[model samples]
Target: MKLKLIAPYLTLIFAFLIISCSSDSSNETPVDPKAANNKSLGTAARDFLSAEAFTGLHVEIAYVNGFKPSATTINNLRNFFSARLNKPDGITITETVVPATTVGSLSREEYVKIEKDNRTVFNAGDELAVWIFFADQNSESDEGNSRILGTAYLNTSCIIFEKTLKDFSNRIGGANLTLLESITTQHEFGHLFGLVNLGTAMVTPHEDEQPDDAGVDKLNKHCNQEDCLMYFQTVGNAVGGVMNSLPTFDEFCLADLQANGGK
Candidate 1:
Protein backbone atom coordinates (compact mmCIF):
# COMPACT_ATOMS: atom_id res chain seq x y z
CA MET A 1 0.00 0.00 0.00
CA LYS A 2 2.85 2.39 0.97
CA LEU A 3 4.68 1.58 -2.29
CA LYS A 4 1.55 2.28 -4.32
CA LEU A 5 1.10 5.65 -2.60
CA ILE A 6 4.72 6.67 -3.36
CA ALA A 7 4.29 5.76 -7.07
CA PRO A 8 1.27 8.10 -7.37
CA TYR A 9 3.20 10.96 -5.71
CA LEU A 10 6.11 10.54 -8.17
CA THR A 11 3.75 10.66 -11.16
CA LEU A 12 2.07 13.80 -9.82
CA ILE A 13 5.49 15.51 -9.33
CA PHE A 14 6.54 14.67 -12.89
CA ALA A 15 3.33 16.12 -14.33
CA PHE A 16 3.72 19.30 -12.31
CA LEU A 17 7.30 19.82 -13.56
CA ILE A 18 6.19 19.40 -17.17
CA ILE A 19 3.49 22.03 -16.72
CA SER A 20 5.93 24.44 -15.15
CA CYS A 21 8.44 24.06 -17.96
CA SER A 22 5.76 24.67 -20.58
CA SER A 23 4.58 27.80 -18.81
CA ASP A 24 8.13 29.17 -18.70
CA SER A 25 8.73 28.50 -22.39
CA SER A 26 5.51 30.17 -23.46
CA ASN A 27 6.42 33.29 -21.49
CA GLU A 28 9.48 33.95 -23.68
CA THR A 29 9.45 36.88 -26.14
CA PRO A 30 7.48 36.80 -29.35
CA VAL A 31 9.02 36.36 -32.82
CA ASP A 32 9.43 38.94 -35.61
CA PRO A 33 6.87 39.33 -38.43
CA LYS A 34 9.29 40.73 -41.03
CA ALA A 35 10.41 37.36 -42.32
CA ALA A 36 6.84 36.68 -43.31
CA ASN A 37 6.13 40.26 -44.38
CA ASN A 38 9.20 40.35 -46.63
CA LYS A 39 8.09 37.25 -48.47
CA SER A 40 4.61 38.64 -48.86
CA LEU A 41 5.91 42.01 -50.04
CA GLY A 42 8.05 40.36 -52.71
CA THR A 43 5.16 38.33 -54.13
CA ALA A 44 2.62 41.13 -54.00
CA ALA A 45 4.89 43.73 -55.57
CA ARG A 46 5.89 41.44 -58.41
CA ASP A 47 2.30 40.62 -59.19
CA PHE A 48 1.33 44.30 -59.13
CA LEU A 49 4.07 45.22 -61.59
CA SER A 50 2.94 42.50 -63.99
CA ALA A 51 -0.72 43.57 -63.93
CA GLU A 52 -2.42 46.80 -65.16
CA ALA A 53 -1.32 48.82 -62.11
CA PHE A 54 2.08 49.63 -63.67
CA THR A 55 1.71 53.05 -65.28
CA GLY A 56 -0.36 54.85 -62.65
CA LEU A 57 2.60 55.31 -60.36
CA HIS A 58 4.15 57.41 -63.17
CA VAL A 59 7.53 55.84 -62.49
CA GLU A 60 10.00 57.26 -65.00
CA ILE A 61 13.75 56.80 -65.55
CA ALA A 62 15.97 59.69 -66.63
CA TYR A 63 19.72 60.11 -66.55
CA VAL A 64 21.59 63.40 -66.28
CA ASN A 65 21.64 62.73 -70.07
CA GLY A 66 25.45 62.79 -70.00
CA PHE A 67 25.88 60.54 -66.96
CA LYS A 68 28.52 57.84 -67.10
CA PRO A 69 26.34 54.80 -66.42
CA SER A 70 24.75 53.36 -69.53
CA ALA A 71 20.96 53.21 -69.70
CA THR A 72 21.15 49.48 -68.96
CA THR A 73 23.12 50.00 -65.72
CA ILE A 74 20.53 52.49 -64.49
CA ASN A 75 17.76 50.07 -65.37
CA ASN A 76 19.48 47.31 -63.46
CA LEU A 77 19.71 49.50 -60.37
CA ARG A 78 16.03 50.46 -60.51
CA ASN A 79 14.87 46.90 -60.96
CA PHE A 80 16.96 45.82 -57.97
CA PHE A 81 15.34 48.35 -55.61
CA SER A 82 11.83 47.70 -56.91
CA ALA A 83 12.11 43.96 -56.47
CA ARG A 84 13.65 44.30 -53.02
CA LEU A 85 10.89 46.58 -51.74
CA ASN A 86 8.09 44.48 -53.20
CA LYS A 87 6.77 47.56 -55.01
CA PRO A 88 3.10 47.32 -55.77
CA ASP A 89 2.12 46.18 -59.27
CA GLY A 90 0.46 49.48 -60.28
CA ILE A 91 3.30 51.74 -59.12
CA THR A 92 6.24 52.82 -61.29
CA ILE A 93 9.76 53.77 -60.15
CA THR A 94 11.75 56.03 -62.41
CA GLU A 95 15.56 55.78 -62.35
CA THR A 96 17.37 58.96 -63.28
CA VAL A 97 21.13 59.20 -63.70
CA VAL A 98 22.65 62.58 -62.88
CA PRO A 99 25.79 63.41 -64.85
CA ALA A 100 28.90 63.54 -62.65
CA THR A 101 29.99 66.62 -64.57
CA THR A 102 26.62 68.33 -64.17
CA VAL A 103 26.09 67.51 -60.49
CA GLY A 104 29.61 66.67 -59.46
CA SER A 105 29.56 66.19 -55.70
CA LEU A 106 26.20 67.12 -54.15
CA SER A 107 26.11 70.95 -53.77
CA ARG A 108 23.62 73.16 -51.92
CA GLU A 109 21.87 73.93 -55.18
CA GLU A 110 22.20 70.30 -56.21
CA TYR A 111 20.82 69.16 -52.89
CA VAL A 112 17.85 71.48 -53.35
CA LYS A 113 17.32 70.16 -56.86
CA ILE A 114 17.47 66.59 -55.61
CA GLU A 115 15.05 67.40 -52.81
CA LYS A 116 12.60 68.95 -55.25
CA ASP A 117 13.12 65.98 -57.53
CA ASN A 118 12.36 63.78 -54.59
CA ARG A 119 8.99 65.47 -54.07
CA THR A 120 8.21 65.15 -57.75
CA VAL A 121 9.29 61.56 -58.03
CA PHE A 122 7.34 60.29 -55.08
CA ASN A 123 4.43 62.60 -55.89
CA ALA A 124 1.28 61.91 -53.86
CA GLY A 125 1.30 58.26 -54.71
CA ASP A 126 3.92 55.55 -54.17
CA GLU A 127 5.98 56.82 -57.12
CA LEU A 128 9.76 57.10 -56.61
CA ALA A 129 12.75 58.65 -58.32
CA VAL A 130 16.23 57.30 -57.64
CA TRP A 131 19.18 59.64 -58.20
CA ILE A 132 22.75 58.40 -58.33
CA PHE A 133 25.92 60.34 -57.55
CA PHE A 134 29.59 59.35 -57.58
CA ALA A 135 31.29 61.26 -54.79
CA ASP A 136 29.96 63.50 -52.01
CA GLN A 137 32.86 66.03 -52.49
CA ASN A 138 33.40 65.94 -48.75
CA SER A 139 35.20 62.61 -48.73
CA GLU A 140 38.98 62.31 -49.38
CA SER A 141 39.20 58.74 -50.72
CA ASP A 142 36.85 57.83 -53.55
CA GLU A 143 38.39 54.36 -53.53
CA GLY A 144 37.22 53.63 -50.01
CA ASN A 145 34.47 52.38 -52.35
CA SER A 146 31.80 54.42 -50.54
CA ARG A 147 29.72 55.68 -53.48
CA ILE A 148 26.76 53.39 -52.63
CA LEU A 149 24.27 55.96 -51.24
CA GLY A 150 20.54 56.82 -51.28
CA THR A 151 17.72 58.16 -49.13
CA ALA A 152 14.16 56.88 -48.61
CA TYR A 153 11.71 59.27 -47.00
CA LEU A 154 8.34 58.57 -45.38
CA ASN A 155 6.17 61.57 -46.31
CA THR A 156 7.95 61.92 -49.65
CA SER A 157 6.96 59.86 -52.66
CA CYS A 158 10.47 58.92 -53.87
CA ILE A 159 13.83 57.39 -52.99
CA ILE A 160 17.37 58.37 -54.08
CA PHE A 161 20.57 56.39 -54.56
CA GLU A 162 23.69 58.46 -55.40
CA LYS A 163 26.19 56.38 -57.30
CA THR A 164 29.01 56.92 -59.78
CA LEU A 165 29.91 54.72 -62.73
CA LYS A 166 33.26 53.95 -61.15
CA ASP A 167 31.59 52.77 -57.94
CA PHE A 168 29.01 50.85 -59.95
CA SER A 169 31.74 49.23 -62.04
CA ASN A 170 33.63 47.95 -59.01
CA ARG A 171 30.54 46.05 -57.78
CA ILE A 172 29.86 44.39 -61.11
CA GLY A 173 29.23 40.61 -61.30
CA GLY A 174 28.81 40.28 -57.53
CA ALA A 175 25.94 39.76 -55.09
CA ASN A 176 27.48 42.09 -52.50
CA LEU A 177 26.28 45.26 -54.18
CA THR A 178 22.84 43.84 -54.71
CA LEU A 179 22.65 42.85 -51.08
CA LEU A 180 23.95 46.22 -49.98
CA GLU A 181 21.36 48.04 -52.05
CA SER A 182 18.48 46.01 -50.68
CA ILE A 183 19.65 46.23 -47.07
CA THR A 184 20.37 49.94 -47.20
CA THR A 185 17.16 50.89 -48.94
CA GLN A 186 15.01 48.77 -46.69
CA HIS A 187 16.79 49.94 -43.54
CA GLU A 188 16.51 53.61 -44.46
CA PHE A 189 12.82 53.29 -45.20
CA GLY A 190 12.36 51.70 -41.79
CA HIS A 191 14.06 54.71 -40.28
CA LEU A 192 11.62 57.11 -42.03
CA PHE A 193 8.85 55.39 -40.10
CA GLY A 194 10.26 56.46 -36.70
CA LEU A 195 11.76 53.09 -35.84
CA VAL A 196 14.11 53.51 -32.89
CA ASN A 197 17.59 52.10 -32.46
CA LEU A 198 18.34 48.70 -30.99
CA GLY A 199 21.19 47.30 -28.87
CA THR A 200 24.15 49.29 -27.54
CA ALA A 201 24.85 52.27 -29.80
CA MET A 202 28.47 51.14 -29.92
CA VAL A 203 30.25 47.86 -29.37
CA THR A 204 32.18 47.66 -26.12
CA PRO A 205 35.83 46.62 -26.06
CA HIS A 206 34.78 43.34 -24.45
CA GLU A 207 31.97 42.50 -26.92
CA ASP A 208 34.26 43.50 -29.77
CA GLU A 209 36.44 40.55 -28.82
CA GLN A 210 33.40 38.25 -29.27
CA PRO A 211 32.87 38.82 -33.00
CA ASP A 212 32.67 35.70 -35.23
CA ASP A 213 36.17 36.34 -36.59
CA ALA A 214 37.74 33.86 -34.17
CA GLY A 215 34.99 31.44 -35.30
CA VAL A 216 32.62 32.69 -32.62
CA ASP A 217 29.82 33.64 -34.97
CA LYS A 218 27.25 32.88 -32.29
CA LEU A 219 26.63 35.27 -29.41
CA ASN A 220 24.71 34.49 -26.26
CA LYS A 221 22.90 37.71 -25.38
CA HIS A 222 21.16 37.57 -22.05
CA CYS A 223 17.56 38.57 -21.50
CA ASN A 224 17.06 42.34 -21.06
CA GLN A 225 20.13 42.86 -23.26
CA GLU A 226 19.40 45.44 -25.96
CA ASP A 227 21.35 46.13 -29.15
CA CYS A 228 20.69 48.89 -31.62
CA LEU A 229 21.32 48.79 -35.39
CA MET A 230 23.24 52.06 -35.12
CA TYR A 231 25.81 50.29 -32.98
CA PHE A 232 29.21 50.05 -34.67
CA GLN A 233 31.21 46.90 -34.09
CA THR A 234 34.77 48.18 -34.23
CA VAL A 235 36.76 45.21 -33.04
CA GLY A 236 35.82 42.09 -35.02
CA ASN A 237 35.62 41.75 -38.77
CA ALA A 238 32.37 40.64 -40.43
CA VAL A 239 31.75 36.92 -40.58
CA GLY A 240 32.18 36.72 -44.37
CA GLY A 241 34.40 39.82 -44.49
CA VAL A 242 31.63 41.24 -46.66
CA MET A 243 29.81 44.40 -45.56
CA ASN A 244 26.53 43.13 -47.03
CA SER A 245 26.33 40.23 -44.60
CA LEU A 246 27.75 42.28 -41.77
CA PRO A 247 25.34 43.58 -39.19
CA THR A 248 24.77 47.09 -40.47
CA PHE A 249 22.57 46.81 -37.43
CA ASP A 250 22.42 44.22 -34.70
CA GLU A 251 19.89 41.38 -34.30
CA PHE A 252 18.38 43.56 -31.61
CA CYS A 253 17.22 45.80 -34.45
CA LEU A 254 14.49 43.32 -35.25
CA ALA A 255 13.74 43.00 -31.58
CA ASP A 256 13.36 46.75 -31.20
CA LEU A 257 10.98 46.81 -34.16
CA GLN A 258 8.85 44.22 -32.44
CA ALA A 259 8.85 46.16 -29.17
CA ASN A 260 7.80 49.30 -31.04
CA GLY A 261 4.89 47.66 -32.97
CA GLY A 262 6.62 47.39 -36.35
CA LYS A 263 5.25 44.72 -38.66
Candidate 2:
Protein backbone atom coordinates (compact mmCIF):
# COMPACT_ATOMS: atom_id res chain seq x y z
CA MET A 1 0.00 0.00 0.00
CA LYS A 2 2.89 2.45 0.84
CA LEU A 3 4.70 1.54 -2.40
CA LYS A 4 1.48 2.10 -4.43
CA LEU A 5 1.08 5.56 -2.85
CA ILE A 6 4.72 6.56 -3.70
CA ALA A 7 4.21 5.45 -7.36
CA PRO A 8 1.20 7.78 -7.82
CA TYR A 9 3.18 10.77 -6.31
CA LEU A 10 6.09 10.17 -8.74
CA THR A 11 3.68 10.16 -11.75
CA LEU A 12 2.13 13.43 -10.56
CA ILE A 13 5.60 15.06 -10.27
CA PHE A 14 6.58 13.95 -13.80
CA ALA A 15 3.31 15.37 -15.29
CA PHE A 16 3.85 18.70 -13.49
CA LEU A 17 7.40 19.04 -15.02
CA ILE A 18 6.05 18.42 -18.53
CA ILE A 19 3.32 21.07 -18.13
CA SER A 20 5.82 23.64 -16.81
CA CYS A 21 8.16 23.13 -19.74
CA SER A 22 5.30 23.50 -22.26
CA SER A 23 4.15 26.75 -20.60
CA ASP A 24 7.66 28.24 -20.70
CA SER A 25 8.06 27.44 -24.41
CA SER A 26 4.68 28.96 -25.27
CA ASN A 27 5.47 32.24 -23.45
CA GLU A 28 8.64 32.99 -25.47
CA THR A 29 8.48 36.42 -27.08
CA PRO A 30 7.64 36.45 -30.76
CA VAL A 31 9.55 38.62 -33.24
CA ASP A 32 7.58 41.49 -34.89
CA PRO A 33 7.85 41.33 -38.71
CA LYS A 34 6.82 44.93 -39.37
CA ALA A 35 9.32 46.37 -36.92
CA ALA A 36 12.11 44.25 -38.38
CA ASN A 37 11.31 45.53 -41.91
CA ASN A 38 11.22 49.16 -40.84
CA LYS A 39 14.56 48.85 -39.06
CA SER A 40 16.09 47.24 -42.13
CA LEU A 41 14.83 50.05 -44.38
CA GLY A 42 16.10 52.73 -42.02
CA THR A 43 19.53 51.09 -41.94
CA ALA A 44 19.62 50.97 -45.72
CA ALA A 45 18.72 54.65 -46.06
CA ARG A 46 21.52 55.69 -43.68
CA ASP A 47 24.01 53.50 -45.53
CA PHE A 48 23.05 55.16 -48.82
CA LEU A 49 23.53 58.65 -47.38
CA SER A 50 26.88 57.76 -45.75
CA ALA A 51 28.53 56.23 -48.80
CA GLU A 52 32.17 57.36 -49.25
CA ALA A 53 31.87 58.28 -52.95
CA PHE A 54 28.88 57.56 -55.16
CA THR A 55 26.11 59.14 -57.20
CA GLY A 56 24.27 59.81 -53.91
CA LEU A 57 20.87 61.57 -54.11
CA HIS A 58 19.78 63.92 -56.89
CA VAL A 59 17.88 67.25 -56.58
CA GLU A 60 16.35 68.76 -59.71
CA ILE A 61 15.35 72.43 -59.49
CA ALA A 62 13.05 74.22 -61.91
CA TYR A 63 12.51 77.98 -61.83
CA VAL A 64 9.89 80.14 -63.52
CA ASN A 65 10.63 83.46 -65.29
CA GLY A 66 12.58 86.02 -63.20
CA PHE A 67 12.60 83.96 -60.02
CA LYS A 68 15.75 81.97 -60.67
CA PRO A 69 17.99 81.64 -57.62
CA SER A 70 21.50 83.05 -58.02
CA ALA A 71 24.64 80.88 -58.14
CA THR A 72 25.64 82.12 -54.69
CA THR A 73 22.26 81.13 -53.29
CA ILE A 74 22.52 77.70 -54.90
CA ASN A 75 26.00 77.16 -53.52
CA ASN A 76 24.91 78.22 -50.07
CA LEU A 77 22.06 75.76 -50.18
CA ARG A 78 24.42 73.00 -51.31
CA ASN A 79 26.94 73.80 -48.58
CA PHE A 80 24.26 73.79 -45.92
CA PHE A 81 23.02 70.37 -46.98
CA SER A 82 26.55 68.95 -47.39
CA ALA A 83 27.47 69.84 -43.82
CA ARG A 84 24.30 68.39 -42.29
CA LEU A 85 23.79 65.37 -44.54
CA ASN A 86 27.22 64.11 -45.63
CA LYS A 87 29.16 64.97 -42.48
CA PRO A 88 32.88 63.86 -42.68
CA ASP A 89 32.94 61.93 -45.96
CA GLY A 90 30.81 64.50 -47.83
CA ILE A 91 28.23 63.42 -50.39
CA THR A 92 27.77 64.70 -53.93
CA ILE A 93 24.84 66.99 -54.81
CA THR A 94 23.84 66.96 -58.47
CA GLU A 95 21.62 69.98 -59.29
CA THR A 96 19.91 70.50 -62.65
CA VAL A 97 18.26 73.89 -63.12
CA VAL A 98 15.56 74.32 -65.74
CA PRO A 99 15.44 77.72 -67.49
CA ALA A 100 12.58 80.22 -66.95
CA THR A 101 9.38 80.53 -68.97
CA THR A 102 6.13 82.52 -68.86
CA VAL A 103 4.21 80.99 -65.94
CA GLY A 104 1.85 83.75 -64.83
CA SER A 105 0.05 84.17 -61.46
CA LEU A 106 -1.58 80.93 -60.28
CA SER A 107 -4.45 80.20 -57.91
CA ARG A 108 -4.25 77.30 -55.41
CA GLU A 109 -6.19 74.91 -57.68
CA GLU A 110 -4.17 75.95 -60.72
CA TYR A 111 -0.96 75.35 -58.80
CA VAL A 112 -2.00 71.85 -57.78
CA LYS A 113 -2.91 71.09 -61.38
CA ILE A 114 0.54 72.23 -62.52
CA GLU A 115 2.22 70.20 -59.79
CA LYS A 116 0.30 67.11 -60.80
CA ASP A 117 1.42 67.64 -64.40
CA ASN A 118 5.06 68.12 -63.31
CA ARG A 119 4.96 64.82 -61.42
CA THR A 120 4.72 63.08 -64.77
CA VAL A 121 7.96 64.67 -65.97
CA PHE A 122 9.81 64.54 -62.62
CA ASN A 123 8.86 60.92 -61.96
CA ALA A 124 8.78 60.17 -58.23
CA GLY A 125 11.81 57.98 -57.76
CA ASP A 126 14.87 58.31 -55.51
CA GLU A 127 15.46 61.87 -56.72
CA LEU A 128 14.08 65.09 -55.15
CA ALA A 129 12.46 67.60 -57.53
CA VAL A 130 11.56 71.22 -56.77
CA TRP A 131 9.56 73.70 -58.86
CA ILE A 132 9.90 77.40 -58.10
CA PHE A 133 7.05 79.46 -59.52
CA PHE A 134 7.57 83.20 -59.94
CA ALA A 135 3.95 84.21 -59.35
CA ASP A 136 2.37 84.65 -55.93
CA GLN A 137 0.14 82.01 -54.32
CA ASN A 138 -3.13 83.10 -52.69
CA SER A 139 -5.27 81.04 -50.35
CA GLU A 140 -8.39 79.55 -51.91
CA SER A 141 -10.62 81.21 -49.33
CA ASP A 142 -8.66 84.47 -48.98
CA GLU A 143 -7.33 85.63 -52.34
CA GLY A 144 -6.23 89.08 -51.20
CA ASN A 145 -2.78 88.45 -49.72
CA SER A 146 -0.01 86.02 -50.63
CA ARG A 147 0.32 83.48 -47.83
CA ILE A 148 2.18 80.25 -48.66
CA LEU A 149 5.94 80.41 -49.03
CA GLY A 150 6.81 76.79 -49.85
CA THR A 151 5.07 73.44 -49.86
CA ALA A 152 6.49 69.92 -50.08
CA TYR A 153 4.76 66.75 -51.21
CA LEU A 154 6.31 64.05 -49.09
CA ASN A 155 4.88 61.20 -51.10
CA THR A 156 6.32 62.44 -54.38
CA SER A 157 9.55 63.82 -52.91
CA CYS A 158 8.72 67.14 -54.56
CA ILE A 159 8.52 70.82 -53.51
CA ILE A 160 6.50 73.54 -55.22
CA PHE A 161 6.35 77.24 -54.45
CA GLU A 162 6.44 80.84 -55.72
CA LYS A 163 8.93 83.70 -55.11
CA THR A 164 7.78 84.29 -51.54
CA LEU A 165 11.36 85.01 -50.52
CA LYS A 166 11.31 88.13 -52.72
CA ASP A 167 7.96 89.09 -51.23
CA PHE A 168 9.41 88.79 -47.73
CA SER A 169 12.42 90.80 -48.86
CA ASN A 170 10.12 93.56 -50.06
CA ARG A 171 7.97 93.57 -46.90
CA ILE A 172 10.82 93.30 -44.44
CA GLY A 173 13.28 96.00 -45.48
CA GLY A 174 16.99 95.06 -45.54
CA ALA A 175 16.34 91.33 -45.88
CA ASN A 176 18.66 89.17 -48.02
CA LEU A 177 16.73 87.50 -50.85
CA THR A 178 19.22 84.70 -51.31
CA LEU A 179 19.29 83.84 -47.63
CA LEU A 180 15.52 83.92 -47.47
CA GLU A 181 15.34 81.55 -50.41
CA SER A 182 17.76 79.18 -48.75
CA ILE A 183 15.77 79.18 -45.52
CA THR A 184 12.55 78.55 -47.40
CA THR A 185 14.09 75.61 -49.19
CA GLN A 186 15.43 74.21 -45.93
CA HIS A 187 12.06 74.53 -44.23
CA GLU A 188 10.26 72.67 -47.04
CA PHE A 189 12.87 69.92 -46.98
CA GLY A 190 12.44 69.68 -43.22
CA HIS A 191 8.83 68.74 -43.83
CA LEU A 192 9.94 65.98 -46.18
CA PHE A 193 12.20 64.62 -43.44
CA GLY A 194 9.15 64.26 -41.19
CA LEU A 195 10.02 66.99 -38.70
CA VAL A 196 8.01 67.87 -35.57
CA ASN A 197 5.04 65.47 -35.45
CA LEU A 198 5.18 64.34 -39.04
CA GLY A 199 6.01 60.81 -40.23
CA THR A 200 9.35 60.71 -38.40
CA ALA A 201 9.04 59.84 -34.74
CA MET A 202 9.97 62.70 -32.44
CA VAL A 203 12.69 62.10 -29.84
CA THR A 204 11.26 64.92 -27.74
CA PRO A 205 8.04 66.96 -27.53
CA HIS A 206 8.88 69.90 -29.79
CA GLU A 207 5.51 70.13 -31.56
CA ASP A 208 3.78 73.52 -31.37
CA GLU A 209 0.57 73.72 -29.32
CA GLN A 210 -0.96 76.59 -31.32
CA PRO A 211 -4.04 75.65 -33.30
CA ASP A 212 -4.17 76.68 -36.94
CA ASP A 213 -7.31 78.28 -38.42
CA ALA A 214 -8.27 74.91 -39.85
CA GLY A 215 -9.49 73.90 -36.38
CA VAL A 216 -7.17 70.91 -36.17
CA ASP A 217 -7.10 69.52 -32.63
CA LYS A 218 -3.48 68.36 -32.58
CA LEU A 219 -0.40 70.58 -32.70
CA ASN A 220 0.58 72.22 -35.96
CA LYS A 221 2.98 70.22 -38.07
CA HIS A 222 5.84 72.39 -36.86
CA CYS A 223 8.37 72.60 -34.04
CA ASN A 224 7.33 74.46 -30.89
CA GLN A 225 10.82 75.90 -30.57
CA GLU A 226 10.62 79.34 -32.17
CA ASP A 227 14.16 79.19 -33.55
CA CYS A 228 13.81 75.89 -35.38
CA LEU A 229 13.67 75.94 -39.17
CA MET A 230 10.57 73.75 -38.97
CA TYR A 231 8.68 76.39 -37.03
CA PHE A 232 5.58 77.55 -38.95
CA GLN A 233 5.72 81.05 -37.43
CA THR A 234 8.93 81.86 -39.31
CA VAL A 235 7.57 81.21 -42.79
CA GLY A 236 5.75 84.29 -44.09
CA ASN A 237 6.02 86.76 -41.18
CA ALA A 238 8.69 89.46 -40.96
CA VAL A 239 7.59 90.78 -37.56
CA GLY A 240 10.00 88.85 -35.31
CA GLY A 241 12.84 88.72 -37.84
CA VAL A 242 13.91 88.07 -41.40
CA MET A 243 15.38 84.97 -43.08
CA ASN A 244 18.77 86.68 -43.59
CA SER A 245 19.86 84.40 -40.79
CA LEU A 246 19.12 80.92 -42.13
CA PRO A 247 17.30 78.65 -39.72
CA THR A 248 18.78 75.33 -38.70
CA PHE A 249 17.60 71.95 -37.46
CA ASP A 250 17.66 72.17 -33.67
CA GLU A 251 18.82 69.37 -31.36
CA PHE A 252 15.35 67.90 -31.03
CA CYS A 253 14.86 67.94 -34.82
CA LEU A 254 18.27 66.37 -35.40
CA ALA A 255 17.52 63.68 -32.86
CA ASP A 256 14.37 62.74 -34.77
CA LEU A 257 16.29 62.52 -38.04
CA GLN A 258 19.05 60.43 -36.48
CA ALA A 259 16.43 58.01 -35.22
CA ASN A 260 14.78 57.87 -38.63
CA GLY A 261 17.81 56.83 -40.73
CA GLY A 262 19.24 60.28 -41.45
CA LYS A 263 22.87 61.38 -40.94
Best by lDDT: 2
lDDT of all predictions, in order shown?
A: 0.30, 0.46
Q: Listing every candidate in turn, what is its Cα RMSD in Å to the true structure after a full C-alpha superposition? A: 20.6, 23.2
**Candidate 2 structure quality by residue, lDDT tens digits, 135-166:** 33322322233234555432223333445456
Segments of candidate 2 deviating more than 4 angstroms: 1-55, 86-104, 107-109, 112-142, 156-160, 171-174, 214-217, 236-243
Q: Please report the TM-score between candidate 2 and the true structure.
A: 0.63
lDDT of 1 by residue, 7-84 (tens): 012232321100000001111121122121112111222222222222233444444443333444445545544442
- 233, model 1: CA deviation in Å? 6.0
The 10 consecutive residues of candidate 1 with the worst lDDT sum are: 16-25
**Regions more than 4 Å wrong, model 1:** 1-92, 96-103, 117-119, 122-161, 164-175, 197-240, 243-251, 258-261
TM-score of each: 0.38, 0.63
